[model samples]
Each structure stands twice: as structure tokens, then as C-alpha cells.
Target: MKPDLPTDLTWPHTSINNNAHRVGFWILAHLTHDPAYMEKVREEIDAAYLTQGPSAEPDMGLLLCDCPQLDAIWHETMWLYNTASAIRKATRACAVGGKRVSVGDQVMATFRQFHLNRELFGGDAGAFRPARFLDDKSLARRKGYAPFGGGHTYCPGRLFAQREIYLFVAETLRRFYLELVGGAEGTMMPGVDRNTPSAAAMGPERDVEVVLSVQKL
Candidate 1:
């Protein structure tokens, strides 16, 4: 964003690339931690690529339009574990739920609070249920989910970000079979810092290690 300097993407590229890697890790971890979920993903992926051989490339259009299970898992991942924060400033003074705010006041919208709202996500809100998204298509987008910022300030790289993440899942399914590093399965979930979610990254409090084995094509 510097006008004085020549156009360079070293920083932007690094940031986006790192985020993609983190997303890949989280997806694999979730799949490993929950064998049932992993089976669901494998079934979906296998069905998706049935017409085209394992070595064949996936059709992006089919993925974007009709891949239900993949879409569910990806959306649920962001809905449940995302750590992106959106900060907004009050343009005009107003009252919110009996709380008053001034024009100059700044409001931070933390996903930790909003995404996990009991009323919005329902009773089993804490559970990782991808079916919610699959079941409710009408009212889901209007609720507490905002993995990427919405409205005018939405992430410009949203499409690219999605495609990149999809490629990670699709390519890995085609090339490698995922496995957990240690015997520790879905025994524990990491603690995350709810106060501040990093830029373009939404994940656990600590790092998770995963292993993948090459599959015969």
C-alpha cells in the first residue's frame, strides 16, 4: 500500500501463503481428530472424483456449485474455530441493548463471542456440526457467521482465499492419505486466545502436528 515504493508482493504473498498453510493444518487435524468426520470427507471426495480418476484434476465449477459435504465442513471449520476479528467505529452515537455509545467510540467485533452465540448457533453450539450449514441455507448467512468481513469492508481476496483452501483439501485428498502424528486422537482441543485473532489466520492456541501418507493413484 505504499505509493513511494515500487509494487511488491513479498509481504502480501507471505501473509496469504502462511494463512493457507495454517488452514490446511487445521482441516487435516479436524479430520484426524474425528474419524467420522474424516470418513465423511473421504466419502465426499471419492464421490466427487469418481467420474474423473484419482489422478485427474477436479472441476472447479462442480466444487463451487454442488459439493455439499466439502462446503459444509469448510464452512463449519470457519464458523466454529475461526479467530478473525472485525473492528468497527461508531459513525453516529447510538444505544445497543441498553448500552449507550458515542460517535467516536470504537467497537471491536470478536468472532470468539459472535460466532459462538448460543441463540444463533443453538443448544449444541459448541459442537462441530457441519450439517447446520447444509440444513439451513436460507437464514444461515443472515446470522452470526462472518468468517470473512461482510458488506463494504469484505476481504478483497475472498474468492482467491476460498479457492486456495479448496485446492489444499482437494489436492491432498487426491495425493495423500492423512494420519495423526501421535496416538493422541481427538482427545483434546486447543485453547485459543479469544481477545485477539490474528490477521488471515484462525486456529488453535498451540500448534498441532499432522502426518500424511502418499496414496496410490
Candidate 2:
């Protein structure tokens, strides 16, 4: 079960209030683009008994948000799409291994490098394969994939955000069908250069787009 938060601490007031939509969008984009993962997600959702009344068999509201499988999907998506570099300030002036180090030295950890590291992620880290997380050994190797930051400064809203994204994607797929319009493809994938702007305040730009048709399934 997911931890409960105070109602007063509701979103828009939370750390991720403003960025939730953007984050959720990226999560769905990755899922929709990867046929294998998408199929799995749909299959799981389909297994839940459907109902026409307010009370459904699976209580999809909870399944889409708090389910383990859905959360895993969100975690994988974040690991693959982390674009922001983590920054830390050094504490206490000191020398490390004879090298002089000063207090407050700005340190940047570009997680993107490690996230895409083939040595750590296997032969083809660039590939979007959620199955990598299904294996206990492989998932254990991803201990350093901290897209939500770490330590005392870690994001408290991480769990909430993941839940939100899961529900959003599930409901979207269950509802209307989405289709990429003509010419949308040309505008989909943008340059990924450092100079290129992100889809969000800190998201990386990628070159790819797929039109979708949203009809009832």
C-alpha cells in the first residue's frame, strides 16, 4: 500500500505540483513508443474485470496508481529519460589523496551518462526494454539509478508522481484512441544538441514522433 499524505499537503503546493503533467507526458510517450512494454501494460489492465457502475472489480483507480507493475513501468521510464544533472556543494575544505579541495566546490553528477552506460546497463542500454528491470540481477545493478535524487534531499513526491503517471497513461489508453496526424512526424523528433531546448524546463530533446488515432477499443 502507498503511504498516505495529508490532504492539506495536496498538489500545486507539493514540490512536483507544477511538473506533474510534463513528467506524466514523458512517461506515456515512452510507453506508447515501445510496443512490447505498451502491450504488457494493456494486458495487465485488461485482466482486471470491467464494470459499468461506480464500483469496478479491480478498482482501477488504485491499480493504475498503486500497483507494483505500474510503478515499475514508471521507474523504468524515469531511469531512461533522466536529463537533468544532479548538483551538490562540497562541505568542509579538505584535501583528497593529496589534492587540495575547498569547501563549497560545485559538483555536478550527470546521471544521463550512467543511465546510458552500456557497461552498466548491458549490451544495448540505448534500447527501451522494460524487461531489463524484470530480472532481479539486472534490476539490482540499477541501484544507482536515482532519478528522484537521493539522501535527505531526495524528492518526497517521487512516489506520488509515479502513481499519477501510471493512472494517467492507463486511463488515456482505456479511453479515446490517439492518432498522429499527417506532418506530425516531421515535428516529432527534434535535435538533441545541448543548445536545443527541452520539451520541459529541463527535459532533453529527442528526434522522433508517431501520430496516433484515438478510437474506442
Candidate 3:
């Protein structure tokens, strides 16, 4: 007989669902804000599927490995919007950053501090520039890019969550053209709602309406 898993084991399941949607929303919003970048990504998606054949469906291998632009956007989105924190309790007394910790003390590490650090991400760390990841692959592997938390507790479903977002963005862009509703003002990027209690992903402070038109084949 199979043994039942602990209820907390469901945390990753719930977390991925909660996080993926928010991440996807911001990704789409960022793409809409930059039409040139959107078109570039769309073209990359088109090219990927074209290689498979005119009547073929998307290949998981291509989606996961072949699309560098899409992957860069995903990394940048995580850098700009991820607000998740890693928390751990001390089994024994220890020191961190010159501070002494008592046994059983809980320590929380906020990802944004590293993500937005100019030293790590450069002068435009505050800006949403996906090319940074594309230009420098090492950026994603750096300690600063910890969207999935870190150490042994690193997110177990990160790969699944990434594929889910990638498929969502690729298919949506391939099938439809999305644009912000208003003229100039609508193109403005929405402000992030940083005040929300600690979450796996940050959300927009205000809603921005968008119009979607079916793409012509």
C-alpha cells in the first residue's frame, strides 16, 4: 500500500497555480507595452513552429529549449516581479551578516534585494530589459536570480511552472494579437502592487484593459 503524504506536500501544488497566473499576466502586460519586443518574440515563436511544418503542433522540446527570446522574457519577468521569500529556522545557533542567531530562530531572505541590486544586475536593474538575460546567460545562474527561492527548499515544481507559462504565452501570442485599449496612455506599464503580503509573484497595482484580435494565418 502507498503511504499518504503530508498535507504540506501540497504547498508546491498550490504555490505553482497561484504564481504562474500572476507571472503570465505581467509577462503579457510587458509584451503589450513593448510592441517591438512583442513582435520579435512572436516572430521567434512563428519560426520555431515553422521549422516543425505548417500543420504541426508546438513541440515541447522547441518550446522549452529553442526559444531564447521567450526564455529571456521569462527570466526578466521573474527578476522584475518575483516577491517570494525564503524562510528557514535555525537548528542550532549561528551567525548571519554579522548578526548572532539563537537556536530555532527563523531567518527570511527576500529575493528582491538581490534581484534589484545594481551591483548584480547593473545600472538599469530597475528597468524591465529581457535582453540582459539573453546577452548574458550567466545572469540566470547567478545567486541574484533566485525566483525559485534557494537551497534544498528550492521550488520542486519550477520546471513544470515554467513550461506552463511558456506554453500559455507562446500559444496565446501565436493565435491572437493583443494590444492595450487606449492610445498613448494605455501603453504605459502598470505599477507593481508591492504592498501585498509576501507572495510567490507580485501583481499589478491597477488593471489595464487590452483588446485581443485573432491572428490571421
Instruction: Report RMSD (Å) for each prediction in the order shown.
Output: 3.8, 5.9, 2.4
| Candidate 2 ranges with C-alpha deviation above 4 Å | 1-18, 34-36, 48-50, 53-72, 94-100, 137-141, 182-217
The residue-by-residue lDDT of candidate 2 on 1-217, one tens digit each, is 9899677865336346445665666656666555566666766664553663333345566565445555566656667766646677779887655977689887766676777888877787766566677664356345567776666757777667656666677666665444333475543523334674432223435534555565444
Taking all chains together, each candidate's TM-score versus the true structure is: 0.79, 0.67, 0.90
The residue-by-residue lDDT of candidate 1 on 52-169, one tens digit each, is 6555866677766667777887777777666667778899999977989899898777765777788877787868788888888753485668877676767678788778888778
Model 1 RMSD to the real structure? 3.8
lDDT value for model 3: 0.85
List, residue by residue over 7-49, the lDDT tens digit for candidate 3: 6756866686668988999889989888999998888777767
Q: Please report the candidate that would top lDDT against the real structure.
A: 3
After superposition, candidate 3 runs with Cα above 4 Å error: 1-10, 50-56, 183-185
Q: How far off is model 2, as Cα RMSD?
A: 5.9
Q: What is the C-alpha lDDT of each candidate?
A: 0.71, 0.59, 0.85
Q: Evaluate model 1: give its TM-score.
A: 0.79
Measured by TM-score, the strongest candidate is: 3
